[model samples]
Target: MEIVSFEQLDSTQNYLIEALEKSQLQAPLAVIASEQTGGIGSRENLWHSSRGDLLFSFALPLSWLPDDLPLGSSSIYFAYIMKETLIEFQSSIWLKWPNDIYYCENKIGGVVTKMIGKNLVCGMGVNLKKNQKGFEALSIGVEPTFVCKMYLNGLDKKPTWKHIFRKYKLEFDYHKNISTHIMGQKISLHNAVLCDDGSLLINKKRIYSLR
Candidate 1:
């Protein structure tokens, strides 16, 4: 992946999406910034990332993944590769179902993936170090650029969805007690079921991560 660095950016996700539309950027490209002023989350909620934190977005060719892959589970696959990358740095980050990165009880980072025509765009934010008053940070001594490189290396393998899903399901226990929102309502994952495609089956309804 090619790295395009910025001292400041409104939103790497939006910038990358627009760049892709204009053909100004190529696939397997990343747009990173020291801080983002207009960060967003899966919901309309803001993802407030501080300076010195890891904030970036990467776009890859959709065809890089398997054709049979379920679109809803892209978050799970992307988060899994990132978690695997961090693990090599000795960071004990666990992925919350759907794709939030948590360190123990506090969230240290997260990832969200979206499709733009033939490209797959993923926005990621990790708190590498914390200020006195802020969300928890990784403190793993790993640089954001190194993390990006590691993620790209793992992604180069193009692992199948089935392979990632099989491993991710085993880690669902980490999220058993966490709270997740569904349709703007607070809900618990204690009774949720992890499907093959990474969707949570709650009350017999298949809740897709992408939505």
Candidate 2:
């Protein structure tokens, strides 16, 4: 995995896309930035990226994955893999139904996936040592690159769905057993549902979907 680090950037996702387009580069590229000024979030929200946080984006060609797997499932698989990694450092870390990483209740990080031509770009932001306002930090300490390398190394092994499923199931179970705190109110995890189409059902209402 090739890593390109920048001291500062408007947004790691935008920078990565531009770099790939400019270079006509294929998939399997990573872009990391020390600071992102205009980081993105789901639904056009701004991703608050404070300095010292982990901000990175990577792309993979669609051919790298199995054709039968839906794009939404792939994102869920990647999110589960990442949640498992963070659990090693912070056991309190829980996955919000789809791809948001939460520390107890407050969001600590998130994952975003976008399709570019026949390729897929997965962007991740983690609040390691620092966090912006309205968010929480992991109680346990971790190196930014340490987490990044774990993901990249796993990818290097070119794991199949069978290999990923074992880990995904375990993390999904853990997520299910946990409770969710929304807007300062505690709610049971049973109210959350993972729909067949990869959308999250909150109180029987569809909420978020990877697509």
Candidate 3:
């Protein structure tokens, strides 16, 4: 993946999407910033970020993705790769079901993915040093560029969905005590069954990550 670094940007995700749409940027490319003034978050929420945070967005052609990977669960697939990358740094970061990145009980970051033309773009924001009022910073210190490179390297490998899902299943027990929102309603995962495709079987309703 080719990486483009910046001191700051309004939103790396937005920039990549717009550039790709305008034919100004290409796939297998990444945009990283030291800070993001306007970051995109889940459910249309803003991901407030500052210096020392890791904010980046990467785009890739659909052909680069694993054949078995579900489009709707792309968020989980990419998010899990990041979690694995941080684990190599000895950080206690774990991916919350769907898209949130958490350290123990506090949220440290999140992931969002979107399709643009024949490419898929994924944006991630992790608090490496700075923290908001309710969120927490990363447990271990890491340079923003270094971590983004490491993550992109992992993504470049294109790990199969079955391989990633197998490991994610082992950790699903950690989320049973938590609840996730669906259609604006909070639903507990206590009885939710994680499907092989990364969706959750909650109350007999199959829910995709769809982030």
Model 2 poorest 10 in a row by lDDT:
178-187
Q: Highest lDDT, which number?
A: 3
lDDT of 1 by residue, 1-211 (tens): 6789998899999999999999988887989898899887767568887777888999988777776579888888888888888777655678887778888778887888889989989999888888667678878776777788778788888888888888888888656887887778888999999987788899898898873
Q: Relative to the unseen true structure, what is the C-alpha lDDT of residue 72 in candidate 2, on a scale of 0 to 100?
A: 68
- When 1 and 3 are scored with TM-score, the better candidate is 3
lDDT of 3 by residue, 19-136 (tens): 9999998898999998888999989899987788889999989998999999999999999998998888665678888999888788888999999999999999988875556457
- Arranged by TM-score with the best first, the candidates are 3, 1, 2
**Comparing 2 and 3 by TM-score, which wins?**
3
Question: What's the alpha carbon RMSD for model 3?
Answer: 1.3
Model 2 lDDT at residue 162:
59
124: Cα error in model 3, Å: 0.3
Off by over 4 Å in 3: 132-134
For candidate 3, give the lDDT of residue 26. Answer: 89
List ranges where model 2 is wrong by over 4 Å: 131-134, 161-208
Better of 1 and 3 by lDDT: 3
lDDT tens digits, residue span 1-211, model 2: 8887888999878877876777666578888888889988755578886766788888888888754456766666667677777877777776665567888767888888888777788888887765536466774566676678887776666666556655555555666866644434565666576555455567666644452
- Error of model 1, residue 207, in angstroms: 1.2
Better of 1 and 2 by lDDT: 1
